[model samples]
Target: MKTIYALLGASLLSACSVPLIQPNATQAVASHYGTSAPQGGAALDVNWWSRMGDAQLTQLLALARTNSPDLRSAAASVMAARAQSGQTGANLYPSLTGSASATISDSPTTPRSDSNTALVDSKWELDIFGKVQNAAKADTARAGAEELAYAGSYVSLAAEVADGYVGYRACRLAQAEYQNALASQQDTVTATGSLVDAGLSASADLSLARANVANAEISVTNQRADCKVAAQSLARIVGVSQSEIDAVISKGGGLPKTKPFQVASVPADMLRQRPDVLEAEKRFAAALLDMKVAEAQLFPSLTLNGSITASDPRSWSFGPALSLPILDGGASRAGVRLANANALTAAESYRAATLTAVSEVEGALTRLAAARSNLASAQSLVANYQAYFDTVDRDWKVGAASLLDREEARRQLQSARITRISQSEAVLVQWIALYKAIGGGWVAPKVVISKDLAPKKIEG
Candidate 1:
């Protein structure tokens, strides 16, 4: 027994002694907006959708939050992880259970008699080597990972809803442009036909005008179809009936406008705020803990177990129990190696995730910059084209120019307007990308959950 205890103690100490690997030497990417990341801005509110200042979008987001299956699954996962953590943590303390028994016996020549017994039993494992402590830590880390995962899912879902809404709005705007273009083209076709009848234009010119009108009609058809598809997608996201979506569509509104958002300057600390990155880090930490646990198993285990029982002929008694491993080939050592390898794999995965996050942020920044530039150019072109169209319309009204000149000016104006609207939508989509790249609003809610909620036993 003494030898067993000594061996167990030695094993526990060795297992607990394994050092935690430090985070790799890779430098964190800096924020691109400034020389340094902001000390603090607005606290990342959970209702980030409302910040966009669109009541309709807010309503849609609310509906999505309630009905999104992904969010539901993530929530369920959090609950499961919490329950698992609680169960593992409970092992660190004494467990008390109530037991009751009734027995009847009959002697060969005597009447039968019954005995009833009821008692509470308590057992505690003395975690002398920190085995249970390590297990508890692993479970806690896992639970934290699950929580981050939930936040990630929520952010992702929100972003998706935003993107889908923006897409629908863009489609609507495009459809409107096509419809307006078709009307203008139809007028041009009519004017060309009148000119041809009056011997002012050739038949070929009329044919060209008719072709333009046909092309415009085709574009309108395609745009309408696209709008319908977008509406269907939005309906699926909000989990509403198609008719309900159509009703929402009946309320005319322009596509969401983009607002200037302050970008972070430094790139290095940006990853720290991303929930997915944080989750990966936590998982890596847990994996390291698991590796330590496996290493601990290489050595013998010392268990201090005691039980007290009262029998018909004996009273309650208690004593310590111990276990030792003499030999099991190289199974224990091999387990340690396996665990170490897993830890290494987890570390690599964490590094990969971090790198990927940086790349995504950088890409989003690039896209946003491009979109901004395009929008500015498009806005300028629209202004210029609008002036040109007004001038040409005035000239043609007084017979200063041919009707074809006015028609061309109108076409140019419509094209410029459509381009501007498309660019504006692009900017909005880019902003969404930026929001997602910056990890959406994951930090605040997670902090709140961790700080306010006490770890409780989760019923599976």
Candidate 2:
């Protein structure tokens, strides 16, 4: 008993010093994005999409999270991976089984004979070299990676939902703009026709006015069609029927107000924020453990097997079993090579994902800044053109300006308004892109335990 206790204590002491295989390559990332802006200490929102202040958007996001088939599929994948991890964890513990049997024989000239046997057996593959331990940890890492995958899906879903909502709203606003222009152009056509009939305007001028009215009608038709498509897209994303989406959109007024864009940090923060990058890290970690498992297979293994029976003459046995690799040809060597290559692949994948994340953040930031600047300039231009149109309209009412001058000013004002609307939508799209680039508010796995990833004593 004393020797056993002493060995247990020694095992406990040495467990802390056990070594593990991990990703060896260092990740050197820049401190700031290429397009650095004003930095704040605010952390990214976990529910960033909801900050748009549109209640319907919030509701749609909630419904999509609950009802979307993509999320459901991802959830199922996580469950399956966790179940597999549990199965692998069983290798860390001893397995016990029992068997019972009864047999009887009878013949015409021989007396009947019966025998009964019952036995309880147990087998434990001692984790001296951490083969089972490494395998268990590898499975744990895989399960964690699957969880991260689910988070990535969630981020993508929310981004798409926001995009559809923004587009639908833009289309609605554009349709309104076209309707206003159509009203104005139709009035111009009526006034021009009256002037042509009175010999006050040329027939060519009246024809041009009619053409403008026709073009205005076509613009309204195209705008309405775009709105329908955007609505359908939102419906598909919400996993609801078109009618339901229509009802939801009917209550929606405009794009949710978002606080002006700011980031706490760039590349440094993205490494922790990006779900895909963290997922790649988990995969690489799992692959490294797999390589360790394969390397351990090259060594001998120790197992404890015990059996006891209850019968007329009771019997029991207990002993240690050892398995040594003998002549497996080149399979074991090839397995090691394969594992090594897979680990290398995982490492490269992680690196590539990191680089991609960096590039996306930089590009999104640049586009966002440009879009904002363009929208500001567009709004200013709209203001100036609208003032010019109002002045010409006043001048025409007093017969101080030609009807052609008023019409030209009106067209310029409408065109400027259209451009401003387009720039506004562009800014919103860029905002979504930036949100997605920053990892969509995903948190990495915090605390997880694999049965064992290092050499440890197996309980007897």
Candidate 3:
């Protein structure tokens, strides 16, 4: 008994010797992006998609949130993590269970008799070694990590829906432009045909008009196909049927308008807003706690475990139980090494995440700036070409310009319009990229623990 008590005391001491995790290489990398950096924005609302000022986009995002399988999977993960944390925490206190039983016996010389018994059994491995505490801490950290992961999923989904909506609108705008060009080409073909019938136009002129009409028809066909594909993709993202998508398409809307918002901030703010970065950090913390748990195993553990059993002829008594690791073939040492290595790896991952996040933000900023410049240039070209085309049209109506000259001016106007639309689409795509780089508005996880297992004082 004395030996057992001594062993238990030694084990308890060893278990309590959980080591502290020093900052590792990964932590150094994370520091480059800065931790808990102050961002110049309000707490991101759940309705972040509404900020884009597109009613259709808002509706699609809502549909995704309601029906997306990925979001549902993420929510399930959060629930699982919460349950696991609670289970681990339960080990921190005594476990009490009750049992009742009845037995019947028959003897050769005596009548049969029945005996009934009921008892409440309680057992607890006192956490003097901090093993249970470390386990609980690790579980808690993991739960937090899972929660961040869920939030990251939601943010990703929102970004995807928004981008798909924008792409769909752009495709529609392209189709509209192509349709107008096709109509202009048809008109040109008709005019050329009338001139040929009147013997005022050459066969070569009719041939050129026929070629323009065919080219316009091809362009329209391609645009329509692209628009159809875009609409289908958008429908898939929002978890709707193709028929529903077609219905939405039947109700026409103009191209998405751009807001004049300036991104005049450093990359660090964007890194801080990213949900992936937060998830990585939480995972890092969990790894650190696991390492601490592994190190704590190298020490002895003390447990006050006892059981009471009563027989038919007597009562029962109990005493403390202790355990110590005398020899385990370096298992504890190996555990410590493995845990430390994992911690190092986790740290590296954190650093990599931070670096990647910063890079994305910087790249998006550069692209957005370039896109804005290109858009301005394209707008100016479109305006100039529009004025020139209008002057040529007036001159042609007054018999001061040749039909060929009018056709050339119309071609230039169409080219300018197409270029402007392309630039506008590029600008919108860049803006979406910038928003994604800025982390799509994630908040920290909220933790709650039950108070049902409050420890009771045991009087001597």
Error of 2 at 341 (Å): 0.8
lDDT of 2 by residue, 318-352 (tens): 99976665446656656767788888889989988
lDDT of 2: 0.79
Task: In model 1, state the lDDT of residue 376.
Answer: 96
Candidate 3 per-residue C-alpha lDDT over 1-460 given as tens digits, one digit per residue, 9 for 90 to 100: 7887777676656545545447574433222332222244444444455665677777777777666777766767777787899999999998877677899999999999998886656777777657788889888877878767766776788778777777777777778888998898788788778877888767777788788889889999998899888888877777778887677656657556664443325555556667778777877887887877787676655555444444432444456654567567768767877787788788888888888878776677677778878989999999999999899978865657767787799888888887887888888777667666677645454423224211111222
**lDDT value for model 3:** 0.71
Q: Which ten residues in a row have the lowest lDDT in candidate 2?
A: 451-460
Q: Largest TM-score belongs to which candidate?
A: 2
What is the Cα-based TM-score of model 1? 0.82
Total clashes for model 3: 10
- Model 3: how far is 64 from its true place, Å? 1.1
What global local distance difference test value does model 1 have?
0.73
**Model 3 ranges with Cα > 4 A deviation:** 1-48, 103-119, 248-252, 260-270, 308-314, 387-412, 443-460
